[model samples]
Target chain A: MKSERANRRMMTRLSIFAVAMFGFGFALVPFYEKICEVTGINNLIKPAAAVVNTQVDKSRWVTLEFDANAHGLEWEFRPVQRSVRVHPGEMIQIEYDVRNNGAKAVVGQAIPSYGPKHAAPFVKKLECFCFKQQPLQAGESKRMPVQFVLDGALPADVNTITLSYTFFEVKGASTAPAKGGVQG
Target chain B: MEAVHGHTNDHSHDDHAHKPSGIMRWVQSTNHKDIGTMYLWFSFTMFLVGGVMALIIRSELFQPGLQIVKPEFFNSMTTYHGLIMVFGAIMPAFVGFANWLIPMQIGAPDMAFPRMNNLSFWLLPPAALLLIAAQFMPGGGAGVGWTLYAPLSTQAGPAMDLTIFAVHILGMSSIMGSINIITTILNMRAPGMTMMKMPMFCWTWLITAYLLVAVMPVLAGAVTMTLTDRHFGTHFFNAAGGGDPVLYQHIFWFFGHPEVYIIAIPAFGVISQVIPAFSRKPLFGYASMVYATASIAILSFMVWAHHMYTAGMPVEAQLYFMYATVLIAVPTGVKVFNWVATMWKGSLTFETPMLFALGFLFLFTLGGFTGLVLSIVPVDVQLHDTYYVVAHFHYVMVAGALFSAFAGIYFWLPKWTGRMYNETLGKWHFWLSLVFFNVTFFVQHFLGLAGMPRRIPDYALQFAEFNAISSIGAFGFGLSQLLFLYIVIKTITSGEKAADRQWEGADSLEWTHLPSPAPWHSFETPPVVK
Candidate 1:
């Protein structure tokens, strides 16, 4: 009888040992993962403030000035002093001061996408005017501009077309980036 | 204790009678049959739920251009479908089989920990609920794909948190279950049933459990970092905050790669058993098969970066991962060769189970070949995240793991339920799934080569015809599973009687003596094996 009791105890101890071993197994890999995170071997996530910047590469530079156009159509391209001779592969920056001169806010989305029929190859986006959703407060304005490289491989025939965008208010405007340059 | 084979007056069955039927019966149950039934049914329900999610995805992907859902909702479908299939469908199905067959095969009375077995299985339902609940959360559900990469997942909404919690629970469940398997196989084999004498299924699962215990926690930790990065302000992945996003991929694949093996090992176990029964011979290279399985499990840990080769890893890291990925072909090739050798000159017949096993052998090896091609560094450069990758995984998951599981279920149904499934309908189900499975996925390889990608709402016109054909096949495959549900139900409700040795070629202890349609409580008193 005592031996039978001892056998039961032995089984119990064995079972506990088994459970402990597996528990150790279960916990060990995750502990390694935690170590990976601490040591940054796993490179876990970290949050930070939003930032934006731009610098011009002199080799790939062209400039256009849409100097102070105060009068135009209800919906018109702000006139620019242009007709400049740019090499087939020269990148150009279009700088313009844009505004919502109307009484109500003007809202719009900027999609910097490739081509009329997949015609333009989007080399890359350095900084897009579309990063933050834009809504011009009533009688508000801002400088909405873009800079892009015309990859040296741009075809010679497609060199003279005007690259343009039109900003129309979304039915119900919600963001605050559109309050840039309207004089009260 | 309940008598295993219902001879309560015999000395071997002494003091083993009268099983309690209420909840306490389960709480304190040591009966392998009872535990097995619980596992099989739980896995079945999870399969049905996960299946419904698959249909939702197929229906939306049926024609592209955002037919029935928004992009976020679409992302949710993809995420949940993967998560559910891995955890809810495949893993649970293997566990169910393990609970039912491991003890019998080893000639043991019960698993090592009876109470913990119940707890581990029960934990599954709540974990499943947490995953399903994420769909209804404010942000719909997790949309950063199933890998849940760092900055994208960390910046994701509350849905990701729920996914993390769900992963934690699932990992715990797998760990617990793995431990139970290890202990049962290690300590409880009958006196003469040494490691070499054990059945192939038991051998395969023992290795599978080792893989599971080692990796599930790695998964838990990967998700935990995602959680803390979001809530605790840690910069583990945020580059702006001194964290590198690529590190998340490294950590995740560390666990994720082994996870693929964890799912496959049990399926390998199932197919190993089924092939022999149908082949009318003992398994060839039993020792070699065991060694190969162990080798595959170890290699799985080293080859994870193959998945990340396209994430802009350094050239040296890429080369190391590439060669390591290719090395997998050696052991995996050994397994296929052994399976074929077992059937080489033997009297082979195609039972439903054997057909699925054969299907798994042929197609999984095909998938592995494509995997070798994919592991090549230059080839992966173009194929990563493309339709090619989708085809590779589907071949393994659906054609390989899932088909082997079906073979196992059909092979063992008679022993488990004491009823014969209608062979005619079983054949029809098999053929339909085979035909449709090939039609759907076989064409995806070409589309991938031509640069079609996954997770897209639309595609170029050149890829349209193949996409449409694949969609139709997906629908057919989806519909065929209903036939499977019908077959299972009809067998339980109305099939004819099953014999003690259901299959003449069967050699395992499961068929050596236990009656068909195992009792509600079985094997409370251990059997002696030689």
Candidate 2:
């Protein structure tokens, strides 16, 4: 009888411990997420901002044509390209168009980079679709242009700067950088 | 009146029961002594296995060129050595000592849960086996360092999975062991022994157990997230997948930071017990020692982020961690001063345990000071991930924990074996280890400050000489450990019989009531404390 009583008491304590541990562990889950969100570190998926890209550089911006299946995107991007070299204090311009080939409207963010060391160029803009999430209506197309001068501060010995963009799907639309160009 | 009026207490002890002996006795043992013996031997085997891995690493690092192991293999050795030493050797060794001593000292018949104690110990062997087998897996054992940082670890091979599994099992074992310790202390003390009257070793275990309880599960959670991220495509840490990698670090150090103290605190306990007994004095300022230990455990949680200063935590966050890390020195300072104060004005004798205890006090304090310096964020930015950090921890752990363990063994081996060890060879073991250990790690601080990073198989031309010297010192230190093996074997096989009271000042209940080798079964009925 005494052993039975002891066993029963032990079971009670064990159950209590189990409950307490669960409560303690569960209490932490919500607290951790709230803290992460408030810190701008919420890596969890959220809606992206919207903006549209417009072609700004008119003349030197050579139009681009590429096979859509090759790059694995649902849109066609036409780019203005080809510059041999630029002397110091020269400007170059480029233009591009994104034609939506998908059945549904899409949202995305465009990451743009430039030069042999791509992604080092700091972009300044009068207007950009990238300022917020981008959204497009179904069966729609848009043109984006990036224009800028090669700063005179660039070393005279250096030559060639190529720009590239990899777009991530966002909630709405992407703003484009201004496009333009001159001799190298 | 040389105790002539005593009612033949000696013969009364003899009259109780002769101890059960040998292999069968150990297999089905519940006695703390038998279990402790098993733990000690097992831990030493692990130390050698881990040491062999260390030697492989050092040999590869003997010169700037890697002649022995490949880079992948070098990474494996570093990972395996750390895992084995931290889990397999030091922590188990301390638990073993606690198992053997806490009940004995507290005057309880056995641990609060004897059957569970056996189960907890038995789990370690299989866990170690699985970890070792991981080396033969598809890409070889965890190329990730002991930290096992995420995304990289997730991207690694099958070996990483196996290592994670091993960590999960080990964490469970630690939790069970720690819970057992906390329960035993809370429920099983003798009637007369208040918390204050409890031995310093028990006091230390109580605190260590608390640290283990609070942190080991966090480690479990961290590893759980790692497992999920690797297998289930959960973005707990992948930035591309909507998870932040730094979050993984925050959770890991929450566990990792206290984990070091978990290893160190019990070593502190061992020294606290050994120092006073050999010094022929009661421990000085026992209350303060208790407070200091408690304070250290509390502070361990606060200082986890100090490790993340380089992880790009906010500057304000860095400042907070830095200050908290340095403040740890105050309580730790109290501990060092208390140890020194205990030795002052006392009739101190340099017994084997005393020799090791004193070694811990000196070397551990130096290590702690370095730890303080590491906490200084500006200093740490340069020292982080360098050999200085390596040297600092080794001085604290190898010199501090391992030395104290050796001392504890020698001090108690007489009472456990009913025989005294050969004093001369024991002294040789002490001197050789102490001299060579310092030689090996002291130079590492210089190598670290000179901008050498750890965990690489090769070095620049300038680092070649120090690498050679450090390797040589390592070999010497490794060989001296064999001297210890000789002493223990020889003493156990044949030596002079010891009296029940092995040391004159030893007053724990183990010396009073239990005979040498304790018994095959004790506290089948609990002994009353008074």
Candidate 3:
């Protein structure tokens, strides 16, 4: 009877420990994220918003190249303008055309990449079509606009930045593309 | 000299000793020996299934072109082979050993929880079914490696769900089984047997059971996250949704690295017992052997990142993992030293059991050395995803754990069956296995060094000759196991009757106190240790 009591007590304790380990496994998710943030290893966290330039820099001109890619998606995507030259403090607008070529409607999400990667923090998007998912009807075509200003604090020696957007097909869609977008 | 005690009062219940005949006997049985038998048979069956998958893989690589299976099916073969062997073969076979030997070794009447033991054994079959059935589902079995790194695991088809569910069930079974073992070992030892005085096998199992309880649930958690990510739109591993895919690797190796020791420590226990019995001496450094095993288990957790060296981490983290991984060799070296010291200058016999244990020693140490080579971050990155890594693990898994299992089986067959196996046939099995196993794996190291990657169906013409030789060796090794099956069957049915004490050097309670073909119920009154 004494050993029986001990066995039961041991079993209960071990069971509780096993349950805690299961929780620990899930805990690893948030714990791993926190470590990544602290160590900046695989940090996907966005950089803090930069201070807006109060004074316009009139002397510097940077060339911006617009590029669009449809990754494994049945869509025709291209930028309307090849490139634009602008002062660091001037806001500029560019348009991209995307058409669903498939028989059925599809949703897409766009991701942006920058060349000379250090320029990423200096270029800010004020208003962009990529802020939300775009759902296009079969054979529907739309031109979406991106508006942004380069920070006047952009590195003085860097005179060119390439902005590219890649669109991936989202498997299911419940939202419509931008309303009142310019038709190309 | 040993005394045969009066156990007249030990057999208090004739009903408990009486074994029922038929399928229901195993279906509803609560006996530890019966459950142990079931575990051995189940693992043996899984071993064959996983072995066939290996042959398929070897066959495809026999000539450096896609000859038999498609690329997808080939990937599936590799994935399932690893899963089946680690989970379904090596782990359970040792549990089988623990079941059959622990209660007898520690002078317990039975496991602490007999009904729970039955539940644990029964859970394995359905889980195995789920794993095998996964291959037939739409979109084929998941080709993600056994670690099942996510994003790929999340995007894999319906079969991935089946694999995940199977992993969950297997984790549950392991947890319950470990709980039962821990309780039985801690609470049921005979009157005079202190923790320090318990048999080496029992001590190793005690540590292994704790490791299992702690990590099996973590594995369940990893798979559960994978499951939710697949269906519920959780971006736990999806980078597009702000989750880093590398996080999955971190969580998996956290469980996976400790999992390596869960399979090896028991094999160490087996060798610790077998090496002494054949050498006709008490184990060398018994206390040190226990300490080394404990230290290895504790160290297993800290060095998981070594497996991910090529997966990319900060330079400081890489350096830390590299040093920590190589540090495992110190305690592992202690175990090897103790086994050899047990044999040094002692009168030795070359019985089948001793032969296999020696084979485990020579080959496992070789595996350990290669593992040390891999621990250096720069070297591992160079050899990453290569046949060299493949050869290193096979040495550990097959020659290390499987060979030790063979040693334990040969060592204890007489006690379990009350008949001696044919010595000549067993020696034949060992020699053939050793020869063919090396023939199959040794050249793979060279192939890896020459820049051949693993898990591919084809290789450059430069790697062709070794691949051909390796395939022939693979077939030879696979066929030699049939001879093992024959020897085991012949021993069980028709071999010569054995003495109550089969080995002169075996000093465990099972030999000194219990009769051969250990009774259906043993130590019921608890033999007092002196």
Candidate 4:
């Protein structure tokens, strides 16, 4: 009888631990974002709302470089303008042209990352084409625009911030050859 | 006195029982031993299945120009091979050992939850089926590698969902099994067998069970998120949906890093028992060994990001992970030193089990050292996703965990089967496996250092020679396992009789008290452990 009670208690404790760990797994998403925010690692930068600072720092000029890569997607993706000189707190727009070179219509999603990762916090994206999936018909081409403002609070030491986007083919969005041929 | 009276009452209740026989016995068995046997057989079958997949991989890599299988199929083979071996073969093999031995060692009638034990074992078959059947699916098995990093996994075919479901089922089985182990170890020890006084195997397993419960659910959550992202329009791993691909890696390795120890600590237990027995000495620094195991478990959680050094983590995060990863060597060094000290100045015998344990000690340390080297951010940046990483894990996983498992099987087969195996054949099996295993994995380190990337079906001409040599070695290792099968079958069918005390130095209750082949229901009347 005593052993039975002990067994029940242990089981209960173990079950609770299991459940807690499961919750903890979900907790890691927000925890991961928090850590990224603190450490400025892995391009997991949380976008901040645009700051309306009346005073602008015109003395400092930072170069914002645009880069694009398409992984396993036969889409020709490139930034229209390679690099731009912008003052702190200045809003700028850039265009990227993408064409589906494949035989059928395709859906693509662009994922953005900022290099000189410390600068990720200051480069706020007010409106970006990366926010949604872009579907293109066969032999179709489209120009996508990203509008962003560099916050005035940007760090002094960082001069160059390279924003790169890699477009991946989204599953279930492409109706043609949906099953087998997609390579990672 | 009350315990003694309870034992008498238990004996009287069992006196008139008639045991079931034949197929029905196994199918309906709530007996721990029966369940254990089933687990062992199932794992061995999966071992062969996974082994065949490995051979296919080696065969294709022999010439490095898509010789046998296509690149996609090759990817599938590697993915399923890793999944099947880790989940289906190695984990279940240790669980089989735990089920068969834990109750007897603790002087208990059976696991605390017998029916749940049966359910856990049975859950494995369907999971294995789902995993295997995935290969025959519309596209193929999951080819995003065993880590199943997203974006790639998101683009995979229908088979990916099957793989995810299989993983969920496997995790469920592991959680239940862990709970059973924890309950039995904590609550069901015989009277007078205090926790500190228990055998090292039980202590190691108790720690392992805790690690399992803590991490398996996390793995379940990771895969479930993958399931939703793949099918339910969830953006957990979709970047366009504001999710990061690296987050999948972080979550996966959170479960994955502890998982390395999950496969390892039990093997440590097996070696701790085998080393002392063969040396005719008590285990050295018993209390310290337990503490070291705990320390390794605790440190395991902190070092997970070491696997992600190349994933562009912050330099500070990399430095922290690197230091914590290197700190693991301290406790691990204690374990190695204690094993050596146990064998120091004692009458020692070179039985098959001891030979494998020594091999495990040597090769596993080499693996550990390479792990240390890989933990450095700069070195890992160069070596990540190379054959060197491949060689390093096979050293730890195959040599560290698998070789120790062989040692355990050889050491305990007589007790389980009531007959001695052919020692000559066992020695031959051990030597061949060691030689061929080295031949296979050693050269791959050079290939990796030479900058040959992993997961490629075709490699540059410079890598051809080593790839060919490694392929031949893999074939030799695979063939040598046939000898192990024959020896086990021969022992079970007919062999020299085994005594209750199979080895002179074995001091555990299971060895000292049980008959040659332990009875169907062990310790129905529990022994007082004094």
Candidate 5:
């Protein structure tokens, strides 16, 4: 009877440990998000905000193209202009129009990426809608502006640049402010 | 103890003489040996099934273009092959070894909970069936890879649901099995057989059982989240709904990394037994081996993020994980050194088991070195999802775990069956498996280094030649297992008779005290250790 009791005790203890580990797995969701928030790891929307001023490379014209994507959100998003030609250091402006097609109010955040990955450091954004979360009521439409200037030293071989923004719907509590640098 | 002895004495006639015969014997079996035998047979059947899938995958990659199967089916083969092999074949095989040996080694009557052990083993076949049946589900098996990272898994068809359920069942089985092992080892050892005095195999299984109980539920939770995300419109992994996909990776790898050790540590236990038996010496640094195995298990938890380096992380986190991942090599190195030192000055004989053990030592080290290489973030980013990663794991899995399993099977066959296997056929089995295994997987490192991504039906012309060679080796390796099957059957039915102590160096309770073909009920009256 003593050994049987001991066996049951051990099994109970292990079963509880296993159940606790199960909770720990779900707990990792929030725990990891907090780590990402504190550490800025894999937080793609947290842009590195830097403004570089130099002589405009008027001699070399770099073609900049804009693209927009809405991932799994009931929003119609598009860039107002398809492409623009600009000098390397010229501060240029572009617009994107987003319309919420869903019945309920929705909050979304935009993440930006560069065409040639190396071009990310060279392009500077003076003001961009991506710096904040956009909340729109049902059937609401809004036009957002993005202003940026390329560094005069962008690489001689780089003649073309493409800037892309993808908007993702933020579920649950969207009260927290968008993360990272906000110089607007 | 007297009452326990009385109970055990009632059933300890000759080998299986008092046991019930016919199908119902196994169907409702409470005997440890019967359950262990069932586990071994089931694991082998799954091994062959998984092996055939591997062969199918290889034959498709034998050429430069889509030669035989569609890319979709190819993806399914790779996915199911991984699932079946890990969950169905390797993990259960080690459990089989544990069931067969643990009680006898510790001089116990049986597992602490014999009925629970039966349920655990019986749970496996249905789970395996669910996994195989998943492939035929209306859009084919879930090709989200074995990790089952979400977004892809959520978007996958009905087959993903089946895979999730199968995983849930398998996890339950593993959890129950681990509980049985832990309780058996902790509560049921013979009088005076303190924890330290128990055999090395028992120690490793104890640690391994703890790990299984810890992480298997994490895996279940992950798959449960995936299940809910698929049907309930939850966004646990959908980035569009505030959930990040990388969150899934974090949780999966947290379970996944430890799962690797769940397979390998038991193999380590098996090798520890086999190596010393062949070398005719006591194990070198027994305490250190235990410490190293524990250290490896603990370190396994921290190094998980290393598996997802390319998935993106802060440079500091990357560096931290990178260093933490590399730190595992220290404990692993201690283990490898101990195995070598075990054979340093002893009277070594290259029996079939020893040959497999040596092969495990050599190739597992190679796998470990490659693992160290992959631990460097920059190097892993280059080799991530490539055949190089493929080559690394097969070395660890096939050569490391599977080879060790083979060694244990050969070493214990005589004790289990009361007959010696044909030595010549066994040697042939070992040599053929060794050569063919390398031929199959060795070139995969080259293909991976050449930038051939894994899980693809076709490869670029540059990788064509190596793919061809690897496929040829796979067929050879697959065929050799048949010879193993034949050898085992031959031994069980009509091989030469074996003495009580089949191997003079096997000094455990099973060999020292129990007769050949260990009695249906051993240690009926508990054997005092001191």
Candidate 6:
């Protein structure tokens, strides 16, 4: 009887631990975001607007290469410019040309990531079409503009950054506006 | 003390009653031994089911070019195969060992909560059914790999929901089982068996149960989120709704990395027991072995992102994960070294169990080294999602865990059944498994290095030759397992009776105190350990 009581108590404690760990798994979502926000690992969501300091680093020339891909969607998507030379901290603008080649209209969401992921924090976007869903009609072509400034604090050893986007078809997204205008 | 004495009196009285007959005996059994037997048989059935799926995959890959199965069907096969083998086969098999052996080893009467023990085992069948039933769902089984990366998983058919539900059930069952184990070990050890003096197998299991308690819920949570995202308009993994797909990888691997150790630590316990027994020596570095197992569990939490290196984590995150992953080799190496040291100057015999242990040590280490190679960011970038990754895990999972399981079974079958197995057949099973296993996976390393990706229905012309060889090896390996089944069945039916101490060098209470074919009621009056 004594052993049974002890066993019951321990079982309860262990079950509680299991329950707590399940909550911790959900906690990991916020925990992961916090870690990525601080470490700048896979944090592609645009950051809050900072004070516009008109300072540009003239000594470093970084090549910004743009790449675009469409997955399981009938669309022609590519960067208007393959690459651009920009000074660190200089504000720049570029466009990606996308056309819906299929007969029917479609919705797409562009997910972006920075290569050499160290540059993700420093490459702040001022305006970009990737911030929302894009709806394109048959034969409709659009030039999506992206405006961004690279932080002067980017490490000296880093000289190139690849900004890539893959467009995925969004089901049931046709209810939203065809052109959900840019946030900026 | 009075309560303990009263319990003994009650059990003695209860032992004389007529036992439940026929199927009711199994269906209503609250006995640990009965539940343990059920768990083992269930796991073996899943092993065969999963093995058949693997052969199907291998046969299709023989000549490449989509000859036998469609690409979508191939994806489903790979996904279900991994899920079944890992969750259905390996995990439950080890749990069966714990249920059967732990109380006996510790000199306890039975599991702390036998009813819960029964519940846990019973939960497994429905879960297994759900997993099998997934293949017949309207759109077929989940094509999303067992890893179930988000967006891909989110886009899957109705079967994905079934898969998610299956994971939840499996996780619940594992959690309850772990709770039962932790409670039994902590509260039910015989008087005088201190924590430090407990058998290494018990120690390994204590840690493994803790790991299960910690990680199974995390897996439950991940799948729960997958469920909500698919049906409840939650954006846990949908980027458009502010959830990041990479976040899903982080959450899954958090559960996943520890999961590798969950399957392995008990195998370590099995090897630790077998090596010392065959060598006629006490385990070398018993204290260090305990510490090393604990360290491996601790470090598992830190290295999860290694599985996601190609998913575009930051340079610093990659470097940290890589270094931490490589660091696991230290404790793991300590374990291997100690196993060797235990056998160095001691009398050694090559029993079937020992052969499997040696195979585990040699092959698991090879898998570990390849794991180290893949830990580097550049190498993983090249090898990620390739056949090399497939080869690496199978080495660890199949050669490492499955082989050790085989060793444990061979080592303990005599005690469990009171019968001696055919030595000749046992050795044949071992050698064939060793050679064919290597033949099947060894060439996969080359295929991976040559840039052949995994999970594809067909491959380029260059991969044809090695794939054919691998398919042949796979068939050989599959057929060899039949010998194991035959040996087990034959031993149970008619074989030489086993002595109380089944192995000459075994020192555990189960071997020394219990009679062959241990009675239904073991340690009714708990034996005091010294």
The residue-by-residue lDDT of candidate 4 on B203-320, one tens digit each, is 9899999999999999999988998988788778877565777899999999999999999999999999999999999999999999999999999998888988887766778899
Give me the candidate number with maximum DockQ: 6
lDDT string for model 3 (A1-184, tens) is: 1378899999999999999999999999999888877775542224334446646688888999989998777999999998999888787889999999988787777767788676876777766766566788899998888888889888988899999887755553454655644321
Model 1 chain B: worst 10 consecutive residues (lDDT sum) = B1-10
DockQ pick, better of 1 and 6: 6
**lDDT of every predicted structure (CA atoms):** 0.73, 0.73, 0.88, 0.87, 0.88, 0.89
Docking class of 4: acceptable
For candidate 5, write residues A1-184 as lDDT tens digits. 1278999999899999999999999998889889877764444444445664657877899999899999878999999999999998787889999999989887787878787766776777777887777877888888988888788878888889988999876665343333544321
Give the per-residue lDDT digits (tens) of candidate 6, residues B1-530. Answer: 00111222225545526458789888888888878888989999999999999999999999968789888888999999999999999999999999999998988888889888888998899988998999998878988999999989988999999899889999989999999888888888888878888889999999999999999999999999999888887888987666788888989999999999999999999999999999999999999999999999999999999999988766878999999999999999999999999999989999899999999999999999999999999999999999999999999999999999999999999888888888889999999999999999999999999999998888899999999999999999999998899999998889788877889899988888877777777787778777
Q: Count the backbone clashes (under 3 Å) in each candidate.
A: 17, 35, 0, 0, 1, 0
Total clashes in model 3, counting residue pairs 3 or more apart in sequence or in different chains: 0
- Report the C-alpha displacement of residue B20, candidate 4, in angstroms: 2.1
Query: A39-59 in candidate 4: lDDT tens per residue?
Result: 555433234454667366789
How far is B476's C-alpha from truth in model 3 (Å)?
A: 0.8
What ranges in model 4 sit over 4 Å off?
A38-79, A82-93, A96-110, A114-163, A166-184, B1-18
Please tell me how candidate 6 rates in CAPRI terms: acceptable
Comparing 1 and 4 by lDDT, which wins? Answer: 4
Tell me the tens digit of each residue's lDDT in model 2 across B1-530: 01111222222233224444567656655556566767778799999999999989888888888698889989989998999999899999999999888877876656666666776777788888977998999878887888888757767888888888888788777776776777677667766778998888999999998777777777777777788878775666654334457777777787788899999999998888888888788889899999999999999989888876776655777899989998899999998999899899988889888999999888999999898899989999999999999999899889988998998999888877778899999989999998889888899999999989998888889988888889998999999999899898898888787776788777777776766645434343444555
Q: Over the stretch A1-184, how does candidate 2's per-residue lDDT look in tens digits? A: 1243453455356435534543443344446667766763342233222213333433232221211111334766555453334333233345556666777776544544345342132222223333333444455776655544444344434345554565445322333322423100
Q: For candidate 3, what is the TM-score?
A: 0.89
CAPRI grade, predicted model 2: incorrect
Model 2 ranges with Cα > 4 A deviation: A1-33, A41-184, B1-28, B522-530
lDDT of 1 at B363: 91
Worst 10 residues of 6 chain B by lDDT: B1-10
What are the per-residue Cα lDDT tens digits for candidate 6 across A4-101? Answer: 67887898888889999999999999998788777655546564367377488888899999999998889999999999999977889999999999
